[model samples]
Target chain A: MQTTRTTPSRLAKRAHYDEATIHPILDEALFCTVSFAVDGQPMAIPTAFARKGNKLYIHGSVGSHFIRTIENGAPVCISVMLADGLVLAKSAFHHSVNYRSVVIFANAEKVTDEAECMEALALITDHLIPGRWDDLRPTTASEMRKTTVLVFSLAEASAKLRAGGPSDDPDDENRPTWAGVIPLQTVRQTPVPAPYNNDTPLPDYLINPQNT
Target chain B: MQTTRTTPSRLAKRAHYDEATIHPILDEALFCTVSFAVDGQPMAIPTAFARKGNKLYIHGSVGSHFIRTIENGAPVCISVMLADGLVLAKSAFHHSVNYRSVVIFANAEKVTDEAECMEALALITDHLIPGRWDDLRPTTASEMRKTTVLVFSLAEASAKLRAGGPSDDPDDENRPTWAGVIPLQTVRQTPVPAPYNNDTPLPDYLINPQNT
Candidate 1:
């Protein structure tokens, strides 16, 4: 697959592009804001996605409008953003945020082959929680029939990111207002047992903080 | 102002019509994903926003492409979502999220009057951080001239929300996979002093967790 990089604009400075910076941000994200046109109107849909190598996979019910739109070979813009902190600045105009985000602009195509569809579904499952495919119950035929998986090659993608403390005006430093970064984070808490469980030990993947 | 509510779809399960849910979510959010069409191409741009009593305000440079498109009176969809957790389920097909979000569909109008322009800026600042307007230096004339603010009356908005734990299939309850929510939150850490600071105490609002 060909790899294309898009430069970060002034507004997109809060977005990052390096592989090291992009992968972690994409991996940590659970949902993406997808924008596409439907009947001459712009529509933004929040959907779950998985990134495998250079391809991004998004799945939904076959009847879903978003899937249908992409099935027709429409270009879609998918964006995933993790808001790390609220940058409280000295000035209103200068106030900003510390966030890491990745945007993929691609022409999505529907995965039609049964084998490829199952693989994409497994990839999505593994992306959400590693080792989930082997551990969880397998999908039934009906489940697969109902699902529509769209795969977009991330060849024309760019990751833009901003981190660290606030960028305040030099002259406003002495102002009494607080000017700094409030670092935000997403942490996985202790898992609650399934109501019908027989008190099985939690998996190492779920209990281990490092795995998260 | 006129008050109207848009019906919620399955994609908008967490939206509420009551003020209790709508007002708080709108007030706490700092930015929104503005989706609009430019040259028949759909784009979603993240920008800072402020909410007044019944209207939401967003401002950017007059030369910004986003502003230029919205100023032409195109229909826009502005959305803010707070993902509360990852709803880990027993099956990959059933996995979803618990989130609180508000999506507003309205025709945007550019704010032109000087008095309304100043009010919108101040409202945005105060929404970002309560009591911040009095603490920081005011916007200069040059700053005002460079910025273009747009106001969208929140009257035509709807809030969709989803809360609580995972919704796993009953048959898969006995599966060994751990099933529950990994709660996500946006927390503010202690502010870091600006490089040029003279070691002044952080403002009371900055230290207040509620301000976030």
Candidate 2:
């Protein structure tokens, strides 16, 4: 699973297969694009993901063709990206985004066990927002039956990242244009309470992150 | 190409294939995941993207296998997503991210014409930061030769979005829990000037957005 060949030829240094790099990026990103080949043509779909121990879990209803295709053991690629900032270089050729991304090459297998399926659902919800799972109603037996949870191993994966300011050429040092890093952040705003739900105060966990 | 079938079986109302919805999402996102099948195994990659008219352009060096693979005319899927918020519902099953996403299924074609290629390069630059192309050092003929630009039509793409607060089941409406949307925004912070460049004032475009 640890292979240098997974890195693209253009900038191999930016790519790595270390578990230390790939897991953190996967944990930070709750949404990912899952790609699979359908009759020789590739298709990509956005879905929620959660990393439980060493496996990545994605869920969809059994009525969905996407899940059916995966139930048949089709090869899949799950990609997650966190765009940190826009690296503004003096030269257009060197312009890039500072991001931490992971590309996981694996196949999805159905988790038929009821206990594991419930755990996967909780993990998926918790991954999106911590502590929400503890407060929300537990998964019902019928709901679990309707859902098809697919599990994939994180054994074959690689990550790429470029942090810091723009890496411009020394020759362009005198270029008068401002060269810098405009940091981009995904921020959580004040919660908009749902209607009909009487003045239930926002939990401390969600409120705390908004402050920072 | 705009079809209701593009929507997942779970929530059909949140999906659309209209150009109006799809183009704006592609324009706002700085990065995307490109998925293609290699030897029957799907590979997904995160890369920078630019929207020009109806085509999405992605550039890579000639030395990159990703670009060379596109130069061979392979079917590729480009996926872009903007996670806007985290929707917490009374039930864990309904917890989701308010996201705008587009999935493009198309084949990549190399841009052989120099004029078009140069325009694509500039479009890519300006797409990242408005008014950046005119200010930066001009791209040399040698730089053009080393870079390969691939253009893919967005004619067969679709977009799906969920923008509102949590949609809870009628049964769980009375649950004593906070149900709402914590909006997530990708914000731009103050630019950090490159080390070698002495205190260069931030540009007008970057400055204007930061003020808001």
Candidate 3:
């Protein structure tokens, strides 16, 4: 989704609006720590999420305090960060990092329509693992009733990213200090069968990383 | 540090604590997003930090708006998160992540003593990359004048951690779907020499990960 001027805070800088740079980082992240105020107190809760198109969905228990507060139209801040590497610079002040992160500040609303909720659930399932929504049993009505799904339109969002190497000071260039980035990555491993699984064949999707 | 019961909200669940489970994860992490209110508006800033002896030190400009607010004894909520793996569950509701994170809610104060600030800075540098502080040039007086350091005692902190594979529904055990974790790691690579380095030798510390 395009970031508008109204929320310039959400705008992405440095190679701005490169879908190739944004989509993969957002899609690969599984947890987002949401920060918001409750009765004047600020609290952050880590929760699972699913993205569908440009909208991000987070589901929690209907009784969760965070869900209740957001349902009241309280402003919320949701952030997803991928720490790529540590940038060691010659100057302490210049020491930074190489990371890709997206922060969205929006008014969240609970999804009410059953059809929309189902679509959101499917989107979440597929977001977590591709090709799995059709392979497993669908969510029962009872389960959906107990869960509260909140939709955050990626309207006011900004992605601040730093990539490449260290920006050290010229004076310290001759200082015999190590300077480089420790590139970080996330990789899916072999699925661990449930304790009760009776040696069933591994799902084709699990066997093939490309499927995801 | 123990989380007291006076404010029950600060008392995290048992699963959130357990230093054995949380220390290594916290040490590996490089950044923390701190949230607080400024003039009734919420602001989250990403900053470098160092943890030593149950205290986390964050340094910034003395004139920084965030540091100014924190110096005034405003309630601060700091969160450090390390995403170990992405949990892809069978059901959307069950989908989660394997992560270790710590959240601290407390009052912060600016380090006023020059000696203490220097020691704290050393701790911060050592924490970021062990043995680097002694190897690099010391901070100049001008650098010290421009910097402000705030310490957050982890005494009131709560560590929350989740590890291992995904937790799926018992009924979905027989379903031919993939269920597992995608391991995530932060890896440091060879330092890229600055253009002005003119092919200087890489620091021994950077070449030896063990020193870090």
Candidate 4:
């Protein structure tokens, strides 16, 4: 859905509107920046998020300012970016980054229903760690009361991305400079167990998430 | 510089108002998300940025909607977040992330002076890969015209960070679930040479950036 607000005015070729291109980028990243205006001034805060079907969920302590400010159905922009690599070109002006980014525009609404809130909370937990939610103790009513859950539809969203080697001008290609991409990868390191652990073996999901 | 807007109302212990706490986080990250309102609707874009002294710089083609909209000295919110790890707790409500984040509210101004623009461009290039800027072909006047650079002051900025393992409740600490930190690290992969490379040796700056 390329609404008037979702389209990019420049470099239009890089913009994408279909869910095939947008949904994976949303699911892959662990967090996103939520942008909105309070009294005509803009503010952006980074928080963990999860995608459940066509809706995105984010939660925080009810007392947090970001949660309180945007829970009233304010227009918000949510952005997620995965930096792939640094694109080095023969010319200084051509230096760019290889990245996949999605920006979504929507009005956020609070989730007041208990079942939906619980499902959203579980979805968020499973989104971060595939099977960890059920393994942990069930959420108590007190914990549910202390948190605020906000939801936004992925109906009006767009993704823009750049990949591969540098696109240098023919004239600059022969220059005596090294040009290419230095790839960046985010890897999960060895997990550090908590001091009070009762020696529970590290879960296989944490070790082999791709299989999950 | 803890203005009403920059201050967080909850979990106040994590907030820091001084440059000693903010500047390093800004420098270590390669980019930030710029947030602003257009026609009363909020928009957020992720772009590469560099910090020089008390100012942060970002640029794009002059034809881009983001550049055209913000070049008029609009009020903007810039946010940088470095996700450290996933903090898994015994209770679902206690699960959180270890991260260092900084948010700044400032008015953006277009760089009109040629000297300052060139300096900012070079600073951004070097900021991404130290010593690579000087090796590339110099920027042409035409190239400068095609670019739009925006700057924001570091004043009115604050940083909030959380590190270490999960903080679970005393009652849940004895639960039979594994709790810990799954550290996330971004590492550079092998560089891929462009198709037209003249067999130029990969520079030390690219291979050993920490030494640079």
Candidate 5:
């Protein structure tokens, strides 16, 4: 489903509200900064999230104040970013980043149904590693109760991305100063076995997580 | 110097209030999510930042709401995260990420003085591409007045990190399930020349930013 365009919460010039643009960023990024407020004070917390359809599921301990504030219907802004590179222009005024970012505004409601909660938990797990959820021991009823799951719909969201190159001042283009991008990348590192893993070989999924 | 610990905004178990631990994460991260409120509604925007001593300098156009709200001394939460890897544990309940993150709280004040603004802009530029600022054209007077730089002190902040491996319940350790981390890494990609570049060679800083 295409996300209907809405007025950006901030920079209207950079906002792009559409599912095609939003989903890929959400999928590529492993961490999202969740913003919420209490008593008029705004705060941002970085956490991992998973998206299915239009809903995003984030988990926390049932007792966490951050989780409670979100599940209690407090307005929240969830942002996921894919920072591509730094845009170093001829002038500092024009310096910017080449990034694809989505900021979702929603009132997250708690996932109270046991079955749905379990499904959300599974999505969160598999989102991090495609099939690891099935490889592990089944989650217990007590564990489910101990966890707090909240779902926020992507029904209303906006994405802003800047690409290409520096928008330098025309006059400075002729100057000897070099102007271009210093590209950034995020890739997987070799996995380390926990000291306790007494010779358990690495799994196929992990050794080749990208399915390469 | 060790970062003096400060109070956490939430989830006391994970909060660390020390500049020593905080600065490294901030220095390592390429972007930070800055949260601010308008009419009591919270918003988060991912932007590049530069830290010098105990202050963070973020640049934006003067007319942007995100900048205006922050410069007005409205409460803001600046969050920087270095997501290391995913910790796939025995059970979903213990699933987590190995990350180093810092959340700073402060009322940002505009850097109005022209010299400071120039220095801040240089810090921001060199922070992204070390030494490039000095190589580029010097800041012009018009640019200084048009840009807005906000300084947020790191006096009240918290850092939280979870490294090592997944902290799973000991009972599940014996299960034959494959459990470990699939480490995540962020690296620089080969630079993409802007379409408009007329064969300007990549600068030394762009080719090897760290100067090593």
Candidate 6:
């Protein structure tokens, strides 16, 4: 939905409201930054997140300042960004970044029910490594007690995207500068087994994550 | 400068206050998310940033909603995060991401001086492509008029870093699940030239960025 807050006053052409444009950005991102106020001062903290339908979930230690300070129904902003490339232009003013980013404004709610909390935890784990959650040991009661999970509805969200090459002025086309895009991608390197991993073979899911 | 807000209530050991530990993370990140309140609600917007000494600079169109809403001395929280690896553990609760993140709580100040503003623009351009600014066409007066630059001091900044392999509990060590670190890295791919790029050869600076 295009609420007053979601609409941009400038460069309005890049804003997107549909889930088709927003969901991919959120799911592709391994983590997101949550913004909230304390004493009227805004703060942003980065943490892992997962999405189930239209709800996004984030968790932290029960004793975390962020988890404790954020009350139920408090307004928050969540943002996820994926930098795709560097847009090099002939002029300094035209230089830009090729990126896909999403911003959501919503009220945070604590997940207290045991079943919901457990499901969110599993979703988060599987989001990180698809199918790995089913293979892992079950969560213990102590572990559940130490975590604080928060959920936000993606009702008020918008996405902005910038892609392709630089948009330099026509006059600067003959400039000596090299103008093009240098693509950036998040890639997985060789997995390193733990010292006590017992020489278990690497899982195929980790080798090829769901998104990549 | 370990202030009350900079200290993490949990995992205090992961937080660091020295510039030696914080500066590299700031320099390595191409962009940062700035958090500020509008009508007592928090919002986070991501933008390109460049650091000069202890001051961080970000710029946007003068008419942007983010630029207009922010005042000269409004309290803002800026955060930069780089995901290093994924920690896959034997248990769901132990799954975590290895990352280096910094959060700063500071007041924002606008740059009105012509020389400083020009320098900041160049710094930002070069930060994206180290030597590209010097080779590009100079900025025009109109471009300067259209942009708004803001700066923040790093006095109250702190960085939290988590690295290495999974730290699963001893009881779950013998579980059949694979436990290790799946390293993640942002890498540069083949450059894509603009359709009207005039066939300019790629620069060596882009091939090997300073940090890489």
Q: Ten residues in a row with the worst lDDT in model 6 chain B?
A: B203-212
Mind giving the per-residue lDDT tens digits that candidate 3 earns over A98-164?
7777767777888899998888777776776676677767788888998888898776666678888
Error at A40, model 5, angstroms: 1.5
Top candidate (DockQ): 4
TM-score of each: 0.88, 0.95, 0.85, 0.97, 0.92, 0.97
Which stretches of candidate 2 lie above 4 Å from their native place? A210-212, B3-10, B209-212
Q: What is the C-alpha lDDT of each candidate?
A: 0.73, 0.82, 0.69, 0.88, 0.78, 0.87
Sort the predicted structures by lDDT, highest score first: 4, 6, 2, 5, 1, 3
Q: What is the TM-score (0 to 1) of candidate 4?
A: 0.97
On residues A62-121, what C-alpha lDDT tens digit does candidate 5 reach at each position? 877689777878888888888888776766667778898888888888988988888888
| C-alpha DockQ of every model | 0.53, 0.79, 0.40, 0.86, 0.63, 0.85
Best by lDDT: 4
Compared with the true structure, what per-residue lDDT tens digits does model 4 show for residues B80-195?
99988889999999999999999999998999999999999998898878898889888999999999888899988999999999999999988889999888777777889998
Number of backbone clashes in candidate 1: 13
DockQ of 3: 0.40
The DockQ value obtained for model 4 is 0.86
Q: For model 3, state the Cα shift of residue A86 in Å.
A: 1.3
What's the fnat for candidate 3, on a 0 to 1 scale?
Answer: 0.30
Cα lDDT tens digits, model 5, B104-192, are: 88889988788898888888877777777877777888877778999998888788888878777889887666667877777776677
- Model 2 Cα lDDT, one tens digit per residue, B72-188: 779888888888888888887777778898888788999999999999899888887878898887799999999999999988788888888888889999988999888877778
